[model samples]
Target: MKKIYNNLTFRVLTAILLGILLGHFAPSTAAQMKPLGDVFINMIKMVIAPIIFLTIVLGISNMGDLKKVGRVGGKALLYFEIITTIALVIGLVVANLIRPGDGVVTTGLATSGSAEAVSRYAQQSAEMDWMDFFMHVVPSNAVGAFAEGDILQVLVFSVLFGMGLTRMGSSGQSLIRAFDRLSKVFFNILNIVMKLAPIGAFGGMAYTIGTYGLAALLPLGKLMITVYVTMFLFIFVVLNLVLRYYKISLWQLLKYIKEELLIVLGTSSSESVLPLIMDKLEHLGCSRSVVGLVIPAGYSFNLDGTTIYLSMAVVFLAQVFQVDLTLAQELTILGILMVTSKGAAGVTGSGFIVLASTLTAVKVIPLEGLALLLGVDRFMSEARAITNTIGNTVATVWLARNENELDMKRLRQVFNKEEIDPLANYDY
Candidate 1:
């Protein structure tokens, strides 16, 4: 009983319930709790850049073969694109079938002043230059990349730095040891920061419900149900089949990462568990090199959840505006989303901008329809974040097994809950 009470999952679940109650009864006060979530996310972000740099550098240097690094990276990217595109198709198929926006009354959906609400996203979308986005991957100022917590930019630098260190061979062993120690220090910091996760969960849930209220979802309930069910099926059906093909058990893998899932559930940010999950994957039997390369790369490229949401939102908006898209137009929208979706790069608010860009490109869906999503978007982010987190985790494990990098015996031990967990033993 005492152990259960101390459990992170239990505490976070309890916090979520308390937050819902407070938001319902005293919204004014609940809104003030935003800082709790914000600060906690900031705390997690505080360590992300350094963790990525150190983990990648150490993993690369230790692996001792730069060609293998490139191979693993290529495989990871290939996997990301394939899985995410499938997710996009799943979203479109489900949305077209259910047609959540078919009967939505646009006027009552707070659409009157929607232009003002979504204008900033439109502006951001217009300002986004995809060439610039790809170019920005090579950080002009490495310090600025770290300071801004730019994962992609930091990633580019870390890979090169690690390669450089690896080429030094025996000459760089001292530095590698120092980096390995520093990485452990940061992981310890991660452990300390995570203890406050329940508080963060409480603040996040309270702020969302207080600001939007359960009533806000009523108007968009059909869309919400459709989105959730689609994601659920994608996870259980699609991801499960992938796991089964690889001879890995989806249930054990999800059970392994349940704490991180709940953290993402409460916080609505897959990034909140980014570094933690990387470390957890290594302990789960992935080589450090594979975990390092796959997880962060998956973070940006393998956004199964975001792709699903983007496709479904486009279809939903077209239905709302009574725009009858022919088969060609729908295919064109799918093509447009394929490009625009990558523009988000896992940024928090950028998902909306990418959606705006997709809508703008499609030239059929009302750009103002983006505003209809604001009230219900937070509620759906849990689904997106959870799926994104799980997808990345699965991708890493799958890639590791395929590359013959996973320690199958050790994986069995960890899944069996027998011994050796680098991330604390949560017995959940």
Candidate 2:
């Protein structure tokens, strides 16, 4: 009994249930818990920049092979594109088949969402420039990137800085040692912050249930069901096949990351677990260089869940308004999402904005229908976040195997036994 109570996984799970009950019974109080989640997420975000900068720079300096860096990066980007496109197509196919919004009465669509909020997202979407996303990759202000916690910008700078370090040869040894110690220090900070996971989980869940309420799901229950069922199948069937081909067990990997999954489930923000996931993947046998390069890059370019949600949301809106989209239009959605979803992560409310951008480009679906998704969007975010985290983890492992950077012997040893604590090494 004492052991179970001391377990983070069990504690988080308990917090989630308590949150749900409190939200159901005392909504006003539950709503005030928002700060708990917000503060915890911010605490996690606080360490992200330094960790990414340090890890990538450390990995690259140790690697000391500029060609290998390029090859690894090229491979990760290619894999992200292929897998995310598949995710978009799968979402479209399922939404078409399920038709989640087939019979919804359109009369109440606008009434469900705040017009001000709808206008805000639409305006943001209109201002989104694909070129700007590309330009920001080479951040003009290095301090600003870290200040804003822009992972993509930091990654770009880290790669360049690391390349510079690699070229310095033996003279760089002292600096490399200093960076290594700094890395361990930040990791230890992460270990302490993680102890608050249950509080964060409780607060996040409570706020969602209190703000949105369980009743919000009923109006769009079919759509919610379709999204959840689709993501579940995608994880169990589609991703499982990827693992089976690579000779790894999906269930085992999921179990190993169970604590991280529960945290993400509660927070509805995968960023909550970004640094922790990168660390766990390295401990699970993926090469540090691959984990550092692929995971952070994957957060931006490889958001499988966002793509799936964007595709399905468009289809749902089309069905709601009874606007029949032709094959070419659907393909247009697939194309636009493949690019725009890359910009979806790392920003607040970016998913809806990205959806608006896709719909605006398609020039078919009614933009106002986006307001309809507002009610249940928060509820569905968990599915999106969980799938994205799992997808990135799998991508890192796959890339490691391809690059011969994975230690298969250690991987098997960890899985062959009970769940190994991913943070045992960082626990100071």
Candidate 3:
């Protein structure tokens, strides 16, 4: 009983339940609990920049072979594109078949708060350009990138810095050691911040339910149900088949990272658990180089869940507005989503912004239709964040296996709950 009470998983699960109850009873009080969640996420964000910088730099410096780095990055990007495209297709197909938005009345719908939310995303979307996105990746000032906490910009700078260190040969040995030590320090900090996850989870759940009461789900219930079902199929059918080919059990992996999943579930932000997942993957025997490279890159490039949601949301809105899209128009949506979804990373309210941009580009769906979804988007965000976390985890492990960097023996032992501590060296 003591152990159960002390367990992080149990604590977070309990917090979620308590949060829901509080929200259901005293929504005004529960809404004020937002600060707890905000503070927790801020704590996590504090270490993310340093961790990404140190991890990527250290991983690349130690790799010793530049060609292998290029090969790994190439393969990872290829995998991301293929897998995310498949996810988009699956979302499109599922939305069309179910037509979750059909037969919905859209006259004089309550767009009070929703209109303002949609307007903000629409403005952001309008300002975005493909050329500008590519240009933004190359930070003009490295310190600015870190200060702003832009993951892609930091990733770009880190890769260059790592490559420069690799060119120094024996001269860079001291620098690499310093970076390794720094990484440990940041991970230790992460360990400390994680203790507040239950508080964060509770606050997040309470605020979500309080701000948008459970009754908000009733009208858009069909779209919500369809989105959840499609994501479920993608995980079990698409992701499961990929894992089985590599002789890994999806169930086992889920069990191993169940704690992180629960965190993401409550927080509805995959970024909240980024450091923990990276640490867990390394402990599971994935190469530090691969985990370093793939995870951050995956956060931006491999957004399987967001892509699925974007594609489905567009289709749903069109159905609600009684707009009939031709096959070519639908294909255009797929192509547009492939690019728009990638832009979602590092931007707040990006999922909606990306959807707004896609709808504007398509010029078929009424942009006003977006008002219908703003109410329920928060509820669906948890599903998207969880699926994205799972997809990236699988991608990292699979890439590690392909590169011959995974230790199967250690993996087996850890899964079996043996006493072997993969983090023993790091001392986290």
Candidate 4:
């Protein structure tokens, strides 16, 4: 049983089969099981702020040469900004052309009941302002930010502390070293916690499918399917282009991190894989500083999947309402998304929040469109998290290669090596 559970293929297949079977026949029990998924999500969320803080500050301060941190970070941020803009545009273009949400005449699309409950919750997401978004990044109390699980705030402080460490000469070096060691300890803890991913995956999937079954997807299946398909294409084709341009093998990278990817697929939160991916990227020859800085930053800005969803959903709403937009209006939407989407990493239900915020930013779409996506948004969150992980992972590698910071021999060894146990020396 342990062997079967450890086998990725076996675990995935078993989970899917069992989840479907339970979802089909015993839905009430499955609905009651949602707490398990909640627990897994909370566990993943629990680590994010601290993990980001420890990793970023330690990764930065440990560097013997801090100058390159700025150089690498600048380049990576630039790359992220460029690609995210393109992603927003692509989503808008495809959505406008396809018009998946147009003229649906969705009856029973009321702002009440289950959808209303979700919409009300989503409305809370809609209320956060852009100024508030910026203000939220500067922690009012550092400890409070961690308690609240605000990753961006933690990241902002980490960068400042790391730079201060760099400037403080030897005295700060000792503290930085301590943080570095602490970061390693946290990673080890995370590694141990992640061993339970299959269980979490099984529980989460069983609960979701068992409760919702295929019926819940009926009303919004087209939108969900469209988003999923577009996300898949973006990961394989668009991300592959970026990877191949850097001479990285997509297959090799995927193969090397199969366990981490599986955990992401199962848990549906990229945050769950942060530690594992950091370790994997380092093993793949990206400089630790590059991985440390770029990844956290990427989380906030380089959300390729979420960007795709925002673009798709916005136009989708417009089409649904049969509203026409001028070229200027579309560009304004793109610009607003560019601002609102960045630095939004680590917000719970942030994709929806960002989508709502983006819609608000453009000032053309009614907040009502957010109501349309309420029922199905939970299903799409996993895709957003997974694609964001892949995009950031690829971005880290590409940035490393661009800076000539990658250890080619180590990368080849890490990605190409095979062993009796896939987890061997692959510890996060």
- Predicted structure with the largest lDDT when compared to the true one: 3
Candidate 1, position 326, lDDT: 91
Worst 10 residues of 2 by lDDT: 419-428
- Model 4: residues >4 Å from true position, as ranges? 1-4, 109-126, 171-177, 361-366, 418-428
lDDT agreement of model 1 with the native: 0.89
- Model 2 error, position 394 (Å): 0.2
lDDT of each: 0.89, 0.89, 0.90, 0.75
Q: After superposition, which runs of candidate 3 have C-alpha atoms over 4 Å from their true positions?
A: 108-111, 421-428
Off by over 4 Å in 1: 111-114, 421-428
* 256-277: candidate 3 lDDT, tens digit per residue: 9999999998899999999899
Could you estimate the TM-score for every candidate?
Answer: 0.97, 0.96, 0.97, 0.89
Q: Write the residue-wise lDDT of candidate 2 on 1-428 in tens digits.
A: 99999999999999999999988999999999999999999999999999999999998997789999999999999999998998999999999999998989766755443678778887888888888777768889999999999999999999999999999999999999999999999999999999999999999999999988898888899999999888888888878887787798899999989999999999999999999998988887887888989999999988888888889999999999898999988998888888788765566798989988888888888888887888889999999999999999999988898888888767886778747665544220
RMSD of every candidate to native, in Å, equals: 2.8, 2.7, 2.1, 3.5
Per TM-score, the best of the predicted structures is 3
The lDDT, on a scale of 0 to 1, for candidate 2 is 0.89
TM-score of candidate 4 versus the correct structure, residues matched by position: 0.89
Q: Tens digits of per-residue lDDT for model 4 on 333-387?
A: 8887887677456666777777766766676777677777766776787788788
Q: How many Å off is the CA of 52 in candidate 1? A: 0.7
- Best of the two (1, 4) by lDDT: 1
